[model samples]
Target: MKKGIDWRYRISNKEAMMGVVLAILNFIWWYAFAYGLGSRPVKDYTYILGFPAWFFYSCILGFIVFTILVWIMVKYFFTEVPFDVDEYKKEETE
Candidate 1:
């Protein structure tokens, strides 16, 4: 019935794409550090803060990094979307 895309749809699509991109980046970060350092022999592994280097970089530090990334994304990239269906309907009928 509508002739063009709605603003809500545009915002939703953008947010969804950003979420997917963040997930992919997080996975890549985890995979690279986990496999790159963990593939070596246990005895040859390095340590950081009493944890294996791979674990430290891939898990502990990753958690911190992604937490900050998510915060920044929400604060800057994400927008506040109204959920008032009645208001939208009223606007459409105007």
Candidate 2:
């Protein structure tokens, strides 16, 4: 039932920008923790929650950060489709 005019709302600039920005942010976060913290001496490193500093920051903390960032972007950047979406659906018999 998709209509011709529905394409206008398919993908907004804000949503696309959020995707790209989040992707870059995720890469930098993981890279920094993996390489930045990982480059330091192992003997001098500290443990967090029974895990090494690098692993804890890169894996555990990174996962949490990613989740939060995604949630934030989805909540703020994405546009909510209007409830009257049926207006965009065209009747094929017409």
Best-matching candidate per TM-score = 1
For residues 1-92, could you state the per-residue lDDT of candidate 2 as single tens digits? 26564554556655777798888988898889888888988897889988988889988999998999889878876776544556545432
Q: Candidate 2: how large is its RMSD?
A: 5.0
- Regions of candidate 1 where Cα sits further than 4 Å from its true position: 1-4, 90-94
Error of 2 at 47 (Å): 0.8
Model 1 residue 17 lDDT?
A: 98
Cα lDDT over the full model 2 = 0.78
Clashes of each: 0, 0
**Model 1 steric clash pairs:** none
- lDDT by candidate, in order shown: 0.92, 0.78
Task: Give residue 31's lDDT in candidate 1 (0 to 100).
Answer: 98
- Runs with alpha carbons beyond 4 Å of true place in candidate 2: 1-11, 82-86, 89-94
